[model samples]
Target: MRFSLWQPGRLLSKKNVKGWVRLTLGDMGGFRNMKSKWAGKTWGTLGDSITAANGYQPLVQDALGFSRVHNYGVGGCPMTAGGERDYGATTHVGRSIENTLDCVTIFAGVNDFRLDKPLGAIGTLDPCTFYGAYASLIEDILVKNPLCRLNLWTPLHRDKDGYDIHYVNAAGYRLCDYAEAVAALGRIYALPVLDLYAQSGLNKLTLSNFTTDGLHPNEAGHRRIADMAISFLRGL
Candidate 1:
């Protein structure tokens, strides 16, 4: 069966359509005039930002005037490129769109670059391959709703001695490579790309800024990321 929208003043059902139909108070021109109250105002984020305990929600609400936001980022998710079978099916790409989100931020690729194990195992993510997969995902999302604006974030920074450094070392995918690849994808799709890898000053800050695990950010780090994102949105 197929579902279709019920135009405001138009007839609810026509002979051409066979499925079910529902009617609502048509567009009253309110939807067009109805600004988000936070339009040009609200900012949204999705990703592992919650794991950081960064007080990102409050910071975003206060700093960006975004009263409504959704955070769907799960730790260890790699942009949903490894297929649903991998990663315990926690990725958001395959999920159905629930709301008309204004801005969607995607923070992925770290896990894809950190698949290290015994027997010389490591992640195999080439920029070209990643871009192709990423583009496909973006296209799928746009097909669902062309009005949703997207902000694709590049992978964060990591030192040579980090736990997952082997993947980067073995694949020769430096932070710059990841940033450039994501930026290229953004340009190709006309989506806004946020260079968190370059913009986030985690390195300049002391180790205290990061979580005890030395990978995820601490509360301070979350605030920093939120601030940067808010600034970028405002500028836009």
Candidate 2:
């Protein structure tokens, strides 16, 4: 049965209400990760954009060979590992790490650049800024699970929607600039980087098939991500 928001009684009656709640609040109209209820198994996912793109689905978890998955993606969140952003992955990833994760993937920073925040330095004293927030999250992960394989995905290439600018920074910085920053940080931290912006092929001409909006990927797009993830995990 479809999750009907209009039928409040039916929604509340479902066993995994959190899944339904994520589906409803995350604007997940597309039929990608809405199938399974994450009933059994292990593992987890935390981040923004594609990491949390197709709602709470097993696409990435299964690709990387995980048991259960936990999604901590909040719309408009950058890697600000939670502080000023508050609702971001940083606020919850530590608590969510109940056991050693086989793999952890992060896809964030589009929102930080979109919002025109100054990308702070990685080791900056301030933990609330964009760069600092991501730094905090990375540090936290290593402390908790040093052996867990970690991957960082660059934001996908997203065109402007209607009249709204998609991912430009204040000084006219393009999304590629933000993506490059993510890559550089990955190098600094010795994390494998997935260059989705350059490789995902979700440009203006091919966007319709992969993305519902210019920003969020549709089912095809999510599957592409899953395939990329699986390839990466296997190669490692």
* Residue-by-residue lDDT tens digits, candidate 2, 193-231: 988888877788887788788777888888887777656
Q: Write the per-residue lDDT of candidate 1 for residues 1-236, one digit (tens) a residue.
A: 33355666665565655775643445422343243344443334545533224365666565555646665655555543444424422234424444467666666655545542111111222223455545665665677757777778776665434633224434556445556666877887888887877777655344355544556666776677678876776565
**Residue pair clashes in candidate 2:** 41-67, 41-68, 42-67, 42-68, 81-90
What are the RMSDs of all candidates, in order?
14.2, 12.9
lDDT for 14 (candidate 2): 47
Worst 10 residues of 1 by lDDT: 116-125
Q: In model 1, how many backbone clashes occur? A: 2
Query: Please, what is the whole-model Cα lDDT of each candidate in the order they appear?
Result: 0.55, 0.64
Model 2: what TM-score? 0.71
lDDT of 2: 0.64
lDDT of 1: 0.55
